[model samples]
Target: MPYFAVLYDYAPGSDPLREHHRAAHRAYLNETDHGTVAVVATGPWSDGEPGALLVVSAPGPGELHAMLDRDPFRLHGAVAQRRIRSWTPVTGPWA
Candidate 1:
């Protein structure tokens, strides 16, 4: 499995909706384990940015894409912008 870093910016005023679907999102992350689809890290960004970052292990690009497609926030328009990138670590824990 390859590592990937995903960042998604939430829509303005979508906090309520995100709160409503928070449980579901967390649940999906917990249950969507396919050995390779491991969510290694996740958290929100500070500085008035309504967004989150997730570092995960995925088998391929399409697998990651499908995972995001199934995310409640993305499906519900809470995610206004995103940047997903493949990571190759040489000195970090993953390395």
Candidate 2:
């Protein structure tokens, strides 16, 4: 499995909606206990900018996209722009 840093580029002023879906979003991340998750974290971008980091793991690009599609926040339009790329962590805990 490979890890990916799924970044959601959201428009400004969407924090409330993002917080509202936090619980469901957390649930989804936790559900990936069978080696499907490498690492995961969520929070606003730099300087209170609107967006989130959804770093996790999948078998490949297809698997990653499928996982993103299942995210609750994705369904509710909390995510504006979704970026998917193969992640290589050189340091830190998940690295």
lDDT of each: 0.85, 0.74
For residues 1-95, could you state the per-residue lDDT of candidate 2 as single tens digits? 67887788874566787689879987876784534545466555777667767777778877677777877888877788899877888799777
Which pairs, if any, clash in model 1? Answer: none
Q: Please, what is the TM-score per model?
A: 0.87, 0.75
Off by over 4 Å in 2: 11-13, 33-39, 92-95
Cα-lDDT of candidate 1: 0.85
Candidate 1 ranges beyond 4 A from true positions: 32-35
Q: Per-residue lDDT of 1-95 in model 1, one digit per residue for the tens?
A: 78999999899999998999998887877775644577888888877678999998898878788877888888888889888899987897899
Say which candidate scores most in lDDT: 1
